[model samples]
Each structure stands twice: as C-alpha cells, then as structure tokens.
Target: MAALQGAVETTAPVSRLHEQRSYDPADFGVPTGREEEWRFTPLRRLRGLHTDAPLPGGKVTVECDPAPEVTVENIERGNRRLGTAYVPADRVSARAFTSFAEATVVTVPRGVVASRPTVISVRGDDPAGAVFGHVVVELEPLAQAVVVLDHTGSATYADNVELIVGDGATLAVVSLQDWASDTVHLSHHHAQVGRDARFTHTAVTLGGSVVRLAPSVRYAGPGGEAELRGLYFADAGQHLEHRLFVDHGERNCRSRVTYKGALQGADAHAVWIGDVVIRAEATGTDTYEYNRNLVLTDGTRVDSVPNLEILTGEVVGAGHASASGRLEDHHLFYLMARGIPYDEARRLVIRGFFGQLIAQIEVPELHARITSAVEAELA
Candidate 1:
C-alpha cells in the first residue's frame, strides 16, 4: 500500500490530538487521577511522589557488571551523551531528571559485538525511602550487545532510562522487576533506533506493591525495526501496569509488541495500554500490537486498551488488539483428561501462557530463574 508514499511532511502536529511531550515539569502539572493518562493509576501508593515532596537520600544501591570490552562511566548531570536518546515526558520523569544527583552511562564502542551481557543490579537498602536514578546506554554503529537491568529488594523508586542504538546496530535489553511486596516503582524508558538497526526490549514484572512502567520507541531513520515483549504476574493486593507507545514517523520502519500477564488472589490488578501512530509520510510502515491477560481467581481486575492512529492508508499494515479473561476451561480439561491432577493442570496452563515469551529470552540462566519464580508463584 503506497497510496500516500512521500505525499506529505511528517513534522506537523495536529492540535486536536493531545501530545505527550515536554521537558518542563510544569507542563504536566500534578496528576490528580482525573487526567486520562493517570486515571488507571493509584496515586495514593506513590507516597507523594507526584507532588512537590523533595526526593530523599537514595535508598537503592546500583552496581554495574559490564562485559570486559564495555565501558561504564558515572558521569555528572551535564554530560554530553545524557539526553541524546530521550527526554522527560511527564511530571515524574521531569522530576527525576531535576533531582538525580548523578547519572550512569554505559557505552558499547562501534562494531564491538559483546560475548557476555552487561548486567546492572539495583538493590534496596534498609529503612527504605524515596530514591531517584537515571541510566543512559549508548551503542555505536554496527555494535551488537545485550544489556540486563535487575531490580530487587524494596524501596519507593522512580527512574528514567534512555537507550540509543546506532545505525546498523543490534541491541537487546532485558529489564526485570523482582521487588519485595512493599516496594513501589515508577519508570520511563525511551529508545531511539537508528537506520537499519534492530532493537528489542523485554520487561518482566513479578513483585511490587505498585509498579508502573512506560516504554516509548521512535526511529531516528528509516529501515529500523523494534520488538517489544513483556510478561507480568500479579498476586494478592498487587498492582502492575505497563504503557507503551511506538511512533512511526520514518519510512520503511516496522514494530511488533506482545505482552501477557496473569493475576491471582484478591485485589490483583493489571493494566496494559498499547498505542501506535503512523504518519502520512511513513508509507512503508508495518506495525502490530496486542496484549492478553489471564485471571486465575476472583477479585482480580484487568484493563487492556489498544489504539492505532493512521494518517494515511499507504502503510503496509497497521493493527491492534487486546483480550482479557479467565483461563479456558477446555485447556484445563484437556490436561485433566490425560489423568493429570487438577493443581498440576492449572499450573501447566499458566506456564504454557508464559512459556512462549520466556523462551524468547536468550539468556539461559535468566530463563531458568524466571521459570522457577513463576512456578513458585503458582505454588
């Protein structure tokens, strides 16, 4: 479908559609739950983070284990490479930008393909308090790398992450949230994919009092590809949310998003929002996004919304879908018909739901660990 190929300029912003872009915190103001973006979120669990309360001393300690060839730098606020990939899009992200005292930058030099993953571990300290952090990952042209970000323990944390993959580069990012039940985390992640580059972002959320993560991707040039995958489990009294946006402003770009979640016990809540925009000039764009949720028990809630806006019919393809429901009785019945016990049958169904995405993870150790944790939750 090349109906509108190269027919219009891509820089014009329509005033009717509310755009979520700004470097100033005041532009977003304070979220009072009445705003469309913040309506699904529980602001009370944020512990005054959205307001003017000053960020306390850091309670989360961060350490990086880089590959032998990689370079890790703890830079000051004004470093030249800090904001190249992303900017603050909301009040909390803007606040994180203004509050963080220092920033961490990890650089993968041009054309260096890493053999081992660059792991960054963030652990919470005792006497948990509010914490703010910023991390920037830069990959030069033709570089290939896998970066893992692990979060554990407990704290009230807010952070911003920026990922830049240069032209002809390949980058895979895995971010896991394995926090204690008392922890609350809010984060914004932005990725800029260069010409003919490939980028994959995988997020796994398992434990938290309230966790909301926003991931946005934009192409710096045409011929870029982006794949976003996520898996989450919500237990009793837990809230987990994931919001994503993929902007297709460049021609010949492609994106695919798939996220699955399971909920059990009372008061478990999960929210997923997938948004994709295809501009008139982006004629060769191909995009699809979908989210699925399985409810394992009563008193659980799930919200899934998929939105697609296409300014031109010239694009190759564009579509979105969302589904939420309890496990299929036929799936469990099929296993039980084979003489398997009821508990084991239920577990198998949940495992099968997540297994497909888990298998996509390239790290064997992380794959085994995540499978074990999912089993523990089912137990």
Candidate 2:
C-alpha cells in the first residue's frame, strides 16, 4: 500500500539503515523492528545474529560438486569478485559478511555452457550454535548455467549470496530451505545483470522457526532481463518471510517477479514484500510484480505488500499487485459436485495454484520434492 517516487530521508539513526548500503556492520547498528524494513520481521527469533553477540562456528557443513564447464572454490575474501554483485544492505548481512573468512565461489568461463547443474549442499550439524557463511557466483560473457543451493538440518544460520551475470550470459539459482522445525535462518541474495544478460532466482522455503530471505537485483548495463520466483509453506507457530527488490537504472531492461505461499494451522505467519524502482534514466523499461497467498485454515496470518516507483514517464510499462485470502468454497463445491472426494478436490486446488511456477523450474526431481513436501504439510 506504500509507494515512493523519490528518495526518503529519515531523522532517526536506525531508520537511516533502511536506505544506507554498506559492508561495515557498524553502519547498520541493530534493528529494533521499528524501522521501515524490519517492522514485519520477528527479530527476537534471530538468535542474536543482528546484535553484538558472537557468530557461532562449526555449526554448519557445506559441500559442493564441481562441474566440467564451471569452477567451484573456497577462495579467500580478498578475491576481486567477492562483493561484485552486492554489498551488505542490513546489519545481519553485514555481520555475515564480516564473520566469514572465505567464500564459496562458482565461476563459469566466457562462452561456455555448463552441461550439468552445480549443486551446493548445506546442512546444519547442531541446533545450539550460530553460523555465518558467504557464497559468490560469477558468469562470464555468453556463459550459461544453473546453480542450486540446498539447505537442511537445524541451526541458527545467516548467509550472504551474490550472483554476477555477464553480458549475454544466463544464470538460474534455486535456494531450498528444508530445515528442522527448530532451525532459524536469515539470508540475503543479490544479483547484478550485465548487458543483454538473463537471470532467474527461485526460492522454496518449507521449514524453520523463523526464516527470512531477501533477494535483490540491480542492472549493470542495458538490455538485461530478470525473473524472480518463490514458493513457501508455513506450519503452526512458524514464520516465513520473503522480500525482493529490483532496481532498474539502465535503459531497455525488463524484470518480472512472482511469489506464492500457503499457510495452515494456528499462529502460522507469512510475509511478502516486493519493491521495484525505475530511475529517470531507465527508459524503455518493462516490469511487473505480483504476490498471491493462500490461507488454508483459521488463525493463520498473511501480509503481502507490492510497491512500484517510477521516476520516468518514458518507461515502457510498470505495475505490481498483491492478493491474500483463503480458498474459495465455490472451487471446492464445484469439484465435489462431480463426485470427487473432498480431500482429493482440495489437493487438486492447491496443486493447481503452484503448478505454473513449479513447471517453470524444468527440474523433475526438484518438482517432486516440492510436491511431496507440500503433501506432507497438508497431512
């Protein structure tokens, strides 16, 4: 419901962090949930990742498989491409950046098309400690590849991920959060699109005590394209949040974003925030963002916010929409009227809602897993 055409200035020091971008953790201070960005988040469940508390170690295990056309390495933080995609935009992200000594970097050479997907598996070893990690993905000119980040187990974890897509290159990234019921995770993903490049970001969140993921994109050159998609399920007493921001500063760029979530049981909560900004110089831009949330039962809560700011009237088009509500009784009645069982009818409706996005992934194994997870949630 909120939109801004120009920069917003605030008097409070904590409020300024919402607009400031920095790599130093000191610049953000600590969030009190009163700031514009953190108001919807449950900061008390973050396990001190935002404050001066120490970031625990040895709580997470990460493994990666190197592909023939792609190179994966645990490089020192001094690597030139470490922060090329994005810098820390908040306190937790800044803390994560400062805590990790090395970053996992995946690089695809120029003009090379990867034959197989590069998979990174991250699992929590214990639930008592906190973990901080970083990941960087770089694609050279005309390169194409897919990267999957699979996370599971139980722990307090925070991470920063960056993706750099070069001119004419294509990159797709999938982040799956299937954790233990008690796990807590916070992550920030940033992507930079080069001239004529293509980027796709997908997120699947199904577990955790409190999980929040922020994915942002900025055009590095003209004619870039970005697609962002997400799906999540929230159970009783669980909190899930996904926030996205796309900044179009170059000419002739295009972006599309779609996110859908389902919630059931008492006290389950889901939040989605989508923001798109088109600068005055971003002529010939085309963008649309939408979010849909399905409340499957009583006592569950959903908050959806979609915002678009256009500083130029020369842009091709720009728009955003958000919808949150329970399933329609007419849909169920229509199906049951054909002699179909109630349970089967409900399942069909749920599947149909998410089928479009799932099919877009084009990965059968992932699709199966997502459906199975949702079925288990419904059971």
Candidate 3:
C-alpha cells in the first residue's frame, strides 16, 4: 500500500505513520531502533544525533563558487527563505533545523540559464565535534541550472537541503558524500517542483563510516517531472543507506528512480528504500523505481525495498523493483573469455553497471571525478 497517502520518515526507512512537518526538534522523538524508520540503522553509531547531541557551528565550513548569473548568500537562521521549500521529516532533520546557525541560499534569476555549474564544497576539520548545516537552492521560472554539493573530511554532521524549481524551470542537483572513513553523516533533501517544471537529483555516496541520505520530492502543480538517480559503494565496516520519497500530488506528473550499489568486505552494509506515492488528486501520474545491488564478497548485507502506493487508479501506471546478489558468473566468464584478465574483467563489469548513470551528469569535472572515485573504490 505504498502508493502512499501519508507516511513519516525516520532513520531506517519510511514508516506508516501520518506525515508531519515541524521546525521544532521537540516535536520528534528519538529513535530507539524499534520503529519502522529506525529498524535498519545502527543508532549507536549516529553520534547521538538522534538523541541529544550538541549541534555545534563552525565545526564544518562551506564554500561556494557560483556562476555569473547566480547569486549566493549566507543568511542567519529564521530567515523566511530558508524553510520555504523544506520541512523537517525526521528527528535528525528537526535537530538540524534548530541547530544550524546560518543557511546558504543560492538563487538563479528568472529566465536566466546559468553558464556554469555551482560548486559548493563542505569540509569538516574536527573529527571530535558535531555540525549542522542548511542549504537552499531556488530556480526561478524558466531558469536552468546545475548545482553540486560536495562533502569531505571527518565529523558528525546533520544537514538539510531545499530545492525550489519554479514553473517551467529545469534544475539538477548532485550531492556527493565522499567523507573520510571515520565520519558520520545524516542528510535530508527536499525539492518542490512547480507547474510544468523539471527536477533531477543525483546522490553519489562512496565514503564515510556511516552515511544516511534521504531525498524527497513533491509537485506543486500539474505536468511537473522528477528524476532521481544514485550510486553507492560500501566497504568494510561501513554503513551506507539511501531513502527516497516521491509524492505525486499534482495531475500528469511523472517520477523515475534508479539506484545501484556495490558492497565488499565483512560488515559492509547498504540499504535502499524507494517510496512512490500517487495521491488521490494525482490523476494521470506515472512513476517507476528500481534498485540493484552487487555483492563483491561474503559477509556483506544488502537491504532493498521498493514501495508504490496508488490512491487513484484512474490514470497512468506505477511500478517498482529491487534486487541484490553476487556478481553474475556468466557475465564475468564472458568478459574473461574475451582475453581480459580476471581483475580487469571484474572492474569492467562494474564500470558498465554504473557508467551509464554517471554519464547522465551534465557537469564534466564532477562526472570525471566520480568516475575516478568509482575506479579507486573498485581498486
């Protein structure tokens, strides 16, 4: 019954509770690992973010290089522009809402197409501290822009990101969680697509001791479109999770999600939860989500779940798929028989699996960097 009418998000996945939005942290309860949303997560490793951990500022730094047509500003908390496109959906998210000192706002003027991609670099210098951050991106009507959020270094971080795509605009956001091995990160991303607008979100998570990313989308008017693509790799003793929600509340809107992941070494774990909801008002809605995982070694864990909730069947179609298993022997054998060494063949197989998705990225530098990082992860 996932073509959902209402549901709440948590650390583990999307739960069946009625959805609620709030800026107050006290409105959300600390997850005890027993709730549906917190079941698959390791709560102890969250650095108390789900509980009472102090969300200090200045522990992490954010730098942005915007295109000539774009404007970037750092505004203090309580700014009206900060939460217009976002709402706290979970405990860590609520905590982040109350903890961040300043929020970064990036705006693309109406009808202006950005000449270059905006690059926002976030780095944590202290592994012993915790940080909270917020970022908002607004694309005015008919504007087109691409934004990249890059995370690195070590720290316990919780952050929220908001994207507002105005009518007829097209916006793409690429978020990378290439943190240090000892880092822990919790992030929430929300996008509001206006009438006839198009939005694309890409999540590339490759590092960190624990990384949990939740990205959700909602349509403001009819004919909106959304596309979500992601790829992640979990190594030994690492926990990487992604939770996605697509709320089709407007007529004739469409959404598509495709996520791929690879796991290796003992204690390497990955989780993917895709939730697509076609509300009663969302007639002629079309959506599909699929997730695939590759197991590179024994002693690895993969949890993949796809949920499609259709409130009104009067329109288009909805579907989802999830699968996880070891590398296909036939594919490997076929490559090896082509005179390719076993190691080279294995890497080639992985490259084929993720290359297509990465190719969709419009940013050349970020695209090349992710390709190199994927190669390094395989090596």
Highest TM-score scorer: 3
Model 1 compared with the native: what TM-score? 0.94
Candidate 2 ranges beyond 4 A from true positions: 1-18
Show model 3 residue runs off by greater than 4 Å. Answer: 1-18, 53-58
For model 2, give the 10-residue run with minimal summed lDDT. 1-10
Model with the higher lDDT, candidate 2 or 3: 3
> Candidate 1: where are CA atoms >4 Å away?
1-18
TM per prediction: 0.94, 0.94, 0.95
Give lDDT tens digits, candidate 3, residues 1-379: 1122112233332324328788888887888998766778899998788996554443789999999999999999987878888889888898888888889899999999999999999998876778899999999999999999999998889999999999999999999999999999999999999999999999999999999999999999999999999999999999999989998889999999999998899999898888887888999998999888888888888878777777887768788877787777888899889899989999998998999999998787887899999999988
Backbone clash numbers for all candidates listed: 0, 0, 5
TM-score of 2: 0.94
| RMSD of each candidate relative to the true structure | 5.8, 3.8, 4.0
